[model samples]
Target: MLDWLTSAALHAFGAPTTWAELLGFASGLLCVYLVVRQHIANWPIGIANNLLLMVAFWHVGLFGDAWLQVVYVGLGAYGWWRWGTGRVEQRVRSTTRAEWWWLAIAGVLLTVALWWYLDRWTESTVPGPDALTTAVSLLATYGQTRRLVESWWLWIAVDVVYVPLYGYKDLWLTALLYLVFLALCVLGLRAWREQLRTAPQGSPAWSMD
Candidate 1:
């Protein structure tokens, strides 16, 4: 598994091109679009994006990120189903501002644990940054699935860290893509906030603004 994954990364990193970068770029745009629009289709599209990124990052030996995409595939599917079922959104469970502190603490603890294990026990090169991104992303994905309205904040924080990390790794295209994602996170937050405000508590469907 290591040999195959490593070889793929080497091949991709060796020849990073406009087309490969654009695939990532376009997917990022579509994801943010669907997210801001509150469309259930976003998850399936997100799954596709993750699969593309899995190959792209794997070829570059960003093992943590590469593997992260694989996990996202599952999460994306779960998110899609959760949204489709209309349970969480119907609940309209907005977290208190205090919950943000809890999410921060959780993000920090998870990042520390992953960084330590991946760096110390494994042969991960950028484990600290990689694990941190993955941890924040986990929270964001969970929040998103549950329609908790806090997901965008988590994504904003993650995107800030990701821009520099991807740039340092010479994933210039991805770095640029994240800039767009940062903006989208802000938009998504506002959009979802409006969604929650007008939506009747315990109602299932959101009206388009």
Candidate 2:
């Protein structure tokens, strides 16, 4: 099964398109679509997407991205439970100013740390961008799980970088996937913004101060 998944399914843009990438591409699209609808199922489906992409990234020497998928698995599980328990409303809400500051600080720190590690210890060709996208992905995924309205913005930023980075790595299919993701992120942002504007006060939704 592993061999078949890693094997080339076809050729596209002069690169071998593997089954893992194809599956991951489909799951990635579905997962984001579910997320736009605020569906709880997105979490588990996203976990599956992570696993498939982990294999795809590993084969292409994107070690940072491969490890990121492992972390996303845990985060996805947590998100599943959080949404299931209804402890936090699935409605979109703005992050507090302080929360934004902390997220920004963490993103910067993680990017620098990942860049240093990947450059020093790994044979990664695009260590700088790999680390950047990995770090932003962590932050964005966490924000999405929290149902923050700003998470879509973060995803848009990551998708912009990912499209070119994957193309450079000869992951043309993955690059094209990010292009689709870029569009989805825009739609998600608009939808979430509308939700935030219309949510009633004193509802279960998290309030912005």
Which candidate has the highest lDDT of all? 2
**Candidate 2 error regions (>4 Å):** 202-209
Supply the global lDDT for candidate 2.
0.91
> Which residue window of length 10 is worst by lDDT in model 2?
200-209
**Total clashing pairs for each candidate:** 3, 0
**Regions of candidate 1 where Cα sits further than 4 Å from its true position:** 1-15, 18-20, 91-93, 96-105, 202-209
TM-score per candidate, chains pooled: 0.82, 0.95
Per-residue CA lDDT of model 1 for 34-104, tens digit only, reads 87777777888888788777766766657778788888899898988777776455544577778778888
Q: Kindly list the per-residue Cα lDDT of model 2 for residues 26-92, writing each as its tens digit.
A: 9999999888888888899999999999999999999999999999999999988888888676577
